[model samples]
Target: MTEPVPAASAPSGGCPAHADVLPLYGPRFLRNPSELYREMRQEHGPVVPVLLEGDVPAWFVIGYREVHHVLSHPEVFARDCRRWNQWDDIPPDWPLRPFVGYQPSTLFAEGDEHRRRAGAISNGLFAVDQFDLRLRSERIADDLIDAFAGRGEAELMAEYAHPLPLLALAGIFGMPEEETPGLLRDMMTTVNGDEGALDAYQGICATMERLVAHRREQPGPDFVTRMLNDPANLTEEELIADLVLVMTAAQQPMAYWIGNTIRLMLTDDRFSLNLAGGRRSVGHALNEVLWEDTPTQNYLGRWAARPVLLGGQQIDAGDLLVLGLAAANGDPRVRPASDTPALGNQAMMSFSYGEHRCTYPAPELAEVICQAAVEVLLDRLPDLLLAVDPEDLEWSPSVWMRGLVGLPVGFTPV
Candidate 1:
């Protein structure tokens, strides 16, 4: 493990001047981030000094090994956002506040507490039967496909990919079918960080609170009930916070995983050639998406515990570090050329890594949901083809997530 330098205690050889820091947002980054990542790597090496929305300074960890090191050694790069040195400058209405703000959820927990909270989450997810999950996912996918099969043309993003995971989550969370629509609405808004995002966040929290209360009165064979019954004995408040985390975590990224995989199959000859035949190719496309266009491109992340030397750059105590997951996966030292197929390579930083990574069975369950969604969609619409030019596909504009705004496709009518 690398040690953090003492805070200004040693002679300071400055790294990059604050003025030279790259801006992480704007049209350039949103247009083609892969090219930008390559430029940053060449100019700044592994770690780049960058500015966020308000020109807030932070370090973007773009190296494969560098991201792995930061995630592995939480002692050097901590999760608790209260340690951030720039909070005073952050405005009350900052759009990024919802992400970096300290919450009671497991996302910012540390040490034994993180283990306890995260362990309970793992147990709850593990309680889910994989066979049952696959069946339910297939049912959800079929139902979604049925709604549009007769039309012969549909936007996969809004019509299929976005709704499948949220509907599946509703079943897992023991939500009444009638309420699933509203839950989906709020989750989509919150996850996209839209205009009403904060309100949507509050609404989702309220819904989770109600679900937790209902489960307390009448426990069921669901993820929430399992968490409530876990030996960790989480308080209602803790349960609500964590449930919100689980809900948000499950929806947007899972949707993108499905959408991106579908986009890959439609555009790439390798997977498109095998789409209607074997399941093995779907698995390959899913793995490829994680490496190339992961839903979470960058995570607003770990704060320095003290001054640290990472990727030959001096990081000050309380400075924020953004984990560039997509960039790390693209590192040529560890991965093949971006244009080359990364077949059979599953070592991507897409789901992140180490303690704070998506816990145990959660990743497995996610794969179950994704695979079922992809296979069932292809099985239902074997003739599916992109309705628009590949160049016309617009991605969601957030720096954090990588997903298409919509994926229009045409197929033979049922």
Candidate 2:
């Protein structure tokens, strides 16, 4: 493995009283976030000040209990961005504007509005047939494997991990196959903050709005239709926002989760042996990945409803607070000292908890997709091995998400 990158020094000294607003989007932070997290926890307790893309200051909650406390108490900490007093201060040209900006989705809603919008999502997901979903996922996996099986070498993240979820979601959303690629490309560009990210994001939302209109004219047994017919009675704008929410929530994280889990299976000897010997299932590998390297590393942006002390830090009513789901999962306080199996332990904060917990079937869907994809690749090319050193694998430079940029592998041509 490559030598670990040294943690970036806090803008001020290491003391909380002189705590620095750490940068969240720099290359240094992405290269060694765990080291930075450890330092943040050691010096600033749970609530540490950090700078977002435009050097916007916000409190980052890094402790296990602190994250739970903030997520659980929505009455004190709200998800509505309208409560953020510093919203006007954030410049429009900020790179993170697309994400941190206000939107009328369930993610940024609170109170009765949140319940209603979230209920629509829950109902749509509940209406899905798990058997059909798994069957489609397996078919997508098989097709993707078939495309590169004879090549004997491929970049799994691009060829397999990234496309699987997008294809499956296209079927779930009842979108035409031909339109899937453009949508995926645009959404990915937007998420990665590439050049013209805002334009790509607009394209994605416009496509979603068009799909919502088409679904209205021609309803089907898809998530969009179900959500449209839901008793929550979401308006046209809200329906489009919800569709965007479902698409973003499902595609990006699912792809990353599958890629990370496969990395663990191929690189970790104990996990590989357990799986090869039938001592552990793909679910076990997935759970380990979720605990150690969750796809959504940081989330749950909550604005303080009023001035209150949290994690020994004083905060104002309109200040923003973010939950460090990844940091909390690895916090020494809640995690066991030894490497214990996490098969049945679903307590990981990959999906935040309480009133605004992730409503999508992320964990279950990720398990199904990863299991299908990995099994096909291994069965088709048993000698598959990493093409580059494991340490050289590049991670996407996303502050809110943890994902590999690509995973290259080589094997004997079949």
Candidate 3:
């Protein structure tokens, strides 16, 4: 836990514009957000007024119950980004625009429209053969391990953790083998919300457009084709845009899930005992990462559909509320002690909650991908150990993601 810093003055129960809000970005937050969440919860209740990049004001929902409340009551805290009242101040090139900027995607849709797209997506994903997915994931993992098994050392993040999910996803989409690497690059760039994010997002959309067009002409036993044939009858525009949303939702988080689980197994003594051949330990490590170090930490989030009092603060219509998933998982009212491993508990809010949560079989599919990636690597390199000190393994700097920058490790040569 990090040392406590002085909290910003509490919200005046009025417009957040005048409040002395906490800035959500910066090195401190990227380095240790749980400690900051703890301090914020102590000072202000669960809902704290916070400033995003460019001093944009929003509410950060940190309490377990409070986050559950916000997610459950979509009528009050809605998904539509257009309801935001700060658009007047936002520029087209804002770094965070990709998050709040409305597209025709299912991510920001609400009510019946959301169900249509979500239902189609769920059905499409449900159609995926879990056994086939596992087989493909194992093959991909084996291929990735082969490249580094001889060297006796590797940086797992770039070489293994990141690529495995994308590679598997590409196969599911029936994307050409040569096109996947570029797709992977653009997807990473887009999600990081950095300098080239907008361009990369456009590139992703263009690629999706071409894929949809090709599938329309020549349907196959792939996810895109399944969605195209769904009963929802999504328009070409909706299919293209929502395909981007699907990729965005699946790839990055799955990568971090694999990476964080491996990190836990390597660093924690409990997991080390079973590192060589314990599926049970691997399962525990994966679950524990979801509770303690969820990949999607904070989501760009619900807008207040109308003025309402919540957590002792009066939220005005059009106010934005960021869901604090990691913080909620650590809430003292519900979570176990910091030192205790959350082994069997699957109730963590890591995959948000409510209708907007990761839909049905999608989470199941992600688990198949992630579990296969970890199990295969362990089977191949049972003696894997961190090359650098545990403290030296730095995390990615993005406030939205919780993943290592790189995970360098070494093992005996095969």
How high is the lDDT of residue 289 in model 2? 82
User: Candidate 3 lDDT, tens digit per residue, 237-292?
Assistant: 99998999998889999999999999999988899888866798888888999999
Query: All predictions: root-mean-square deviation over Cα?
Result: 5.2, 3.0, 1.9
111-211 per-residue lDDT for model 1 (tens digits):
99999999999999988899999999999999999998999999999998888998888888898787677888998777677888788888889899888
What lDDT would each prediction earn against the true structure? 0.87, 0.80, 0.89
lDDT for model 1, please. Answer: 0.87
Tell me the number of clashing residue pairs for each predicted model: 0, 0, 0
Candidate 2 lDDT, tens digit per residue, 99-184? 76788888888888898999888888877777887888888988888888888899999999989999988887888787788998
Task: Give candidate 3's error at residue 132 in angstroms.
Answer: 0.7
Error of 3 at 311 (Å): 0.9
User: What value does the lDDT take at residue 82 in candidate 3?
Assistant: 94
Over 4 Å off, model 2:
1-19, 274-279, 336-338, 360-362
TM per candidate comes to 0.94, 0.93, 0.97
Q: How does residue 248 of candidate 3 score in lDDT?
A: 81
lDDT of residue 219 for candidate 1 = 89
Better of 1 and 3 by TM-score: 3
Worst 10 residues of 2 by lDDT: 10-19
Best by TM-score: 3
